[model samples]
Target: MPARTSRMTLGRLLGLSRENNRARDWFFEDSGNLLPHHRHHELNPSIPPLEVTKIALRLRHLIEECVPCELEESLITQAHSRVITREVVLAAKEAGGEEYRSCVVFALLVCSRWFKRQAHLELWDATLHNVRSTACEVIAKAIIEGEEDMSYLLHTVLLHRFSILVNGKPTPPANAVEKAVDLHALRVICSSGYQKCLQYLWRGWLVQDEDDPTVFVDYRGRDDQRYIVHLDPDRLRAPVYQNIARLLFSFIYLALYTMSINSVNPNGEFDAAEILLFLFTLGFICDEFTKFWKAGYHILSFWSAFNGVLYAVLTVSFVCRMIGLSYPIGHELRHSYDSLSYNFLAFAAPMFWIRLLLYLDSFRFFGAMLVVLKVMMKESIIFFALLAVMVVGFLQAFIGLDLAEDLKTDEIWFIIQAMANSVMQSPEFDGFEKFAPPFGILLYYVFTFIVMVILLNILIALYGSAYSDIYENADDEYMALFAQKTMEFVRAPDENVYIAPFNLVEIGVIVLFSWWLPKRQYEFVNDVVMAILYSPLLLIAAYFESRKAGEIRRNRSRGEDDDDTVEEWEQIEDQIDFEAEGWTKRCAAVKANVETDPAVIEVRKLMDEVAELKLMIAELKKGMDGANGKKKDDVKKGSEGDGEDS
Candidate 1:
């Protein structure tokens, strides 16, 4: 189709009808728990050649219109019937567009409503896996793009559904059976969705080339072509880049620290700029430590060690500076103690290199090599430490021999050199037993062989094994890493403004002033001044970014090929069965939660009591019947006796 005609035709494919107009008033974003809002009105609008979109849109609207208490099974089934149909999915694949993708995702939320309907978890997961695994990219692309129509239609329905499941569980139930059913269903959906999301993440990452000239699906979703030109992160160009703001801030912190002490007062009293910069560095490092702790960093990761080491160095330097500052100028302690801070600061300069590598962690080769090195280092360090002690002992022993008579340095240095396979003129024991016995040379050679051949080979083996495991899981590991980074980058709402001094200023400006100001005035300042003043740089960048984004969308509308053929390596057939086990585990977990739920426990107790009461009532009725029969028998026997007497 020609560009003009494609626009003329597809543009008109959807328009604001009276039906959708009503839905526009109270549009629900991606929170699966629907609040009762204008429920008296309902609409089902359709755009042809894309029935899936229509179905998904209506279904989403339906979900928002009714809460779980009021949600009708018929409505759920109806929505699901439309979603399960091939019309939407096929439309998405054929059109190769976001709109079609959006429809399929919308349709998929029917699973949330139908959660109570499906009970057998493993079977349900298997069914969903087999059905949706192939279309992982389609679903992921929808999430990645995350485009909302002007009407606020097509939000992240699956994520919304997850929120609903998590929050809806603890509520007091109107019906225990219904609640249990829903709980089981929600758990199934959540578990299945997580596995499905992993597949989605994998499929999305599978196609990315990092070097793609056009664009790659990243968390920022900004046009990389324009954004890469000026990589001034935390400035105008920063927000447009994906997952680089914190990294950029780290570099900025390094720069501030380096520049702080370059020119100190001749009198040894640090200038105000120097003091200010040190304070900034201290604040930044503390924040980094806080973020590090909050992120739950493992000691096993090289970055964790790097961050910890940097923070420690900065802390020691800060303490020295503070101690020096405490003393009066021209005092002997001031200059002398201040130099200690400078000394530590100099040591920390090398850490900036490690920070750079950590920032570029998304690079595959860089990351893979780091993984290999980390494994090698972690495994060998302890062993080498022990070997160092033994080697020192041997060297001490060797120094006592006549062979060490010409040694210049300590025996420990010669031992270290020999063990490191370095050239050394000393420790030349010619014709054994010059000062020591022949047994000495024999022991030394034995130790050398063990250290050189055995330990070296062991270290090699450990590195090789670690590398192999990492290599085997390279794709999954990278995808998981990328996904986590992206999620973390976007997870915090304040990350945009949380850079050093600005964050401190925000406390006073936002917390103190806002409390003193009237509600309307404060909100006005927040909405207008603070938003614009702090973020205009981002806003301008966004405008230019949107222009580029518009071009990409136009290209997409013209039917550019976005779908990548599944490579042999990227095929997920093997993963589905593997995930099937995970799904089963999740099923067991959900079943356990449902069984142990307090509400269910109480319901069980009541039922048990009711059964006992019924049993007691039945026994009492049986006794009464027996008494009535005895009275009748007594009267009959008396009548017979009277007749006999007559």
Candidate 2:
């Protein structure tokens, strides 16, 4: 996880095997009401005085207690209210209806009355500090690897809210519930140990885990929790083929769930396929519970982070299907939760298909293109980020001016329409220019000159330069990508790696015959048989591992020590480069300084020998080429003579 990996400590492995002091797994226990039942409207004003302190304190405690995910589709409270947060708005978009967002909207309405006062601001700041403190408490208690998950708390806060407040001391909006909700979400996530938990799981899953590099595992009790920390580095990694088979089975289940015809079957009827998928999902959920047993330490990567998201989505859907579809739950609850994961899978399913591209990148031609694309994307990120910031600034300025009173006020939709209209020469802009004076015409010109001309050209130039650089060394790019993937496939563990589906033979062997032998021998024999069944993979892994080791040995022999050192190949390239200093005079001055120094005389003698050897190599290559040309000519002449004879 992260680019830097963590290994498991021996103490943690002992804990996993010892099986003592097993802790209770933390889970999502619902808070019944999200918002107040009664409103503080002034006609009767029946509600008590708004006690911000009590509300903040209570909310913090609830967040700390609960998991930061939607176990049930809707909140317990039933109330109608205006939209207050971006999350609810996005959900509405996905659902194609506003009814799905009622709970969150209503909760924000309850906080709306006191959202902008000095007392509330102070309370809000105190709550954030409390959130971080709560997170820090868990972090301090656990052994950490990668960047601390709680470190993201300050970052997400700064990224979303900090910029707006820092720039100009503008009047804070009355409906600042957006920022409030984000903070609340962050608090819940951090306090729930979600981030750390995900990190730990990812470190175990994606990066060969703590015990073995090639195996993916599921545990009955989690080892990342603060109270139950067990960082096992030597947990037996199951075979890669077994994991592949498992993933394929998951796909089969997904296909059955989505594509099976319902008309032929009766409504709410149970089927064998459905039962199997339910069993698998239930097992996945149970496996997730173990991570919570020790759930407050992490080291994560992008893939693992997304895997956590998929886990949440799948659980939401699975629970909803079990309760609403299978049992007697209400229609809305079932439908919403069912849709929750379906909507996410709509986006995520394609991602799996696209990842096959990475495998394709091992091919020479495709690898060059992928490597080039990777280069371009990395270079373009900062440029695009800058453009995004400028767009946000201008768009906010235009909104503050209230230029388009007739059009929609939604910031997201406005940005989309404006980008499209700007590119199309603003077909609807003429009359709107009169809505807000000076700023309106100014917006049109700035859009034309900057967004249309300057930024677009700069982006083009960046792509052109990146393409040239990559294409110039296309072969090297291909080899590097190929080599990187080879290392990933090579350095796998020697034990317990099975060829699944067929490895049923190994499991059957264990069950029928294993009772006679010692437990250790039984395990060893089963593992050996499984490995023998998948001998091809073992041979491949061994071959690459040996090659990689030999390469390292050769590199080390050239004095590329573990300390500050460059590769031998890179050192030779650097010595050959005459234009790194730009002008001929700079190169000359450097050479002269080196030549005159007594300390460099011995090195200069070695340099001369290298040059002489390079020249000799060139002469040999030229002679070989001349001989090859003569052979080609002779072959051509012989073919012509044969034709004449015929």
Candidate 3:
């Protein structure tokens, strides 16, 4: 008792410096001396290690056991498996926190294994979904209640890679990098399109901790909690509302650009519309530049690459327009530059429309489809790589043949056109023989076969594979995309967000004083300016947040659980079947009243009584049969004794 030791709590461990990797390990490990005693006590007691092993082995056996021709055996196996899973899930629910997380991780691992081994077990799909749903609820509730930080869930629970203790050393599982709780959870959350989980994710993005800027930190002093928008009410700066406001602004900008480009006045000075378009484009350029500065190499993503191309064209067009204005009206040079400007601007129209898809990707249909498209595009790289090599080889052959035959250099363009046409399914085979001789025509035919038959088919196969992979796991892919988009917005936090053309004002006005001002003063100035500039959008945000607040209040007053989000999601899911007499509605109605219905209740009781009566009758019949057999055996033995006596 010479020195008293303070106990390590979960909160204290979490508060430890994130750079100390051992702290994270200690927090997550299940073994002795690793976990804090108090935290472990808070968790529901788990089944003994031996029992858990036995249960796991049983589950594995059930998953692997195949009874293809026997339907009854298969059904029995499935029912038994389901009962075991439900029991485990129930235990997990009772034991929350790490216990619940461990159960979910095990379930997902098992599901993956089962999917690989026996995907024909359709009954498992619902059981797996239930496990995921429970996991989602745990994280969602924790985040919604502000009881735990998102960083803890993401890094420690979900994204945390588990290792086996092999000979007193940590050994990583196979494909440990990709197969993690986070990936499974993300896929589940994304597939379900659950709003509560999404809210937790995006909200966590805004959280900033003093110890580690990358992770969210919960402060002991509530007032000192750090968030990007901590100085303001969340109602006024919600990410959802902010993104919606930005989308609306983008549509307006697009409309302005369309009008300006279409109504270009050659040989005349820029009009009001053109001037506004320039400002908006400038604002977008600034936004992209900032993102580039912050995201660096990460800005090389598909969407960002598209943005880069669009901005580059717009910049060139704007420069051309400016140069045209420098020249006198009706001048040849002026008209030439003006023509180039309009043409370039018009060329970007396809990109502008395609970029709109990025905003709409939050919708499940679009989001999932975008994931498919991205994957397909990635797969096309292999086709393009092969095509490039083939094209170069064929091009050289044609050029060499032309040179040998002393054909006009102008004929080279025709050969190029023919090769392209063949690839496009419009083979121009008419003039290939004229280039050199039989060799030229023969080569052309070979090239066509390679391009149209072999290469194209290979490309198609690749595309199909990529498409199937994404579509089969559409929910998870979409969730990953959604998570990516959410991060894109929050990854580079601007001390003050200035959306588009409005950003131009911030740069021209607010930034002028930023260099000379103190850090706090600069931040304060930016916040105040943004609050004023975004007041209208803030009002909209306030309305939505207030309504949500009111709902929570009403729920609490009525002593009802705050499960409004779940209820809303369920309702929305039901609404997907627009027909009044839809299967979902029918199922819900029947389920709700099944237990309460008098007729069904009576019938269930009668069935139970009939089953008991059947058991009694079978026992009585068995007893009477045994008595009759014994009497026959005794009579036979007595007759044998009488014969012996005679």
For residues 75-113, could you state the per-residue lDDT of candidate 3 as single tens digits?
A: 322322332244443443333244434333333343344
RMSD each, Å: 21.7, 30.3, 12.6
| Candidates 1 and 2, the one with greater lDDT | 1
What lDDT does the true structure give each of the candidates?
A: 0.46, 0.42, 0.58
Number of clashing pairs per prediction, in order:
1, 8, 1
Residue 161 deviation, candidate 2, in Å?
47
The RMSD (Cα, Å) of candidate 1 is 21.7
- Over 163-258, each residue of candidate 2 has an lDDT whose tens digit, in order, gives 112233432221111332222332222222333333333223223333433222323222122222222212224223333434554565456545
Off by over 4 Å in 1: 1-242, 261-266, 271-273, 289-301, 326-332, 363-450, 464-477, 492-497, 514-540, 552-646
Models ranked on lDDT: 3, 1, 2
Best by TM-score: 3
Error at 345, model 3, angstroms: 1.1
Whole-model lDDT, candidate 1?
0.46
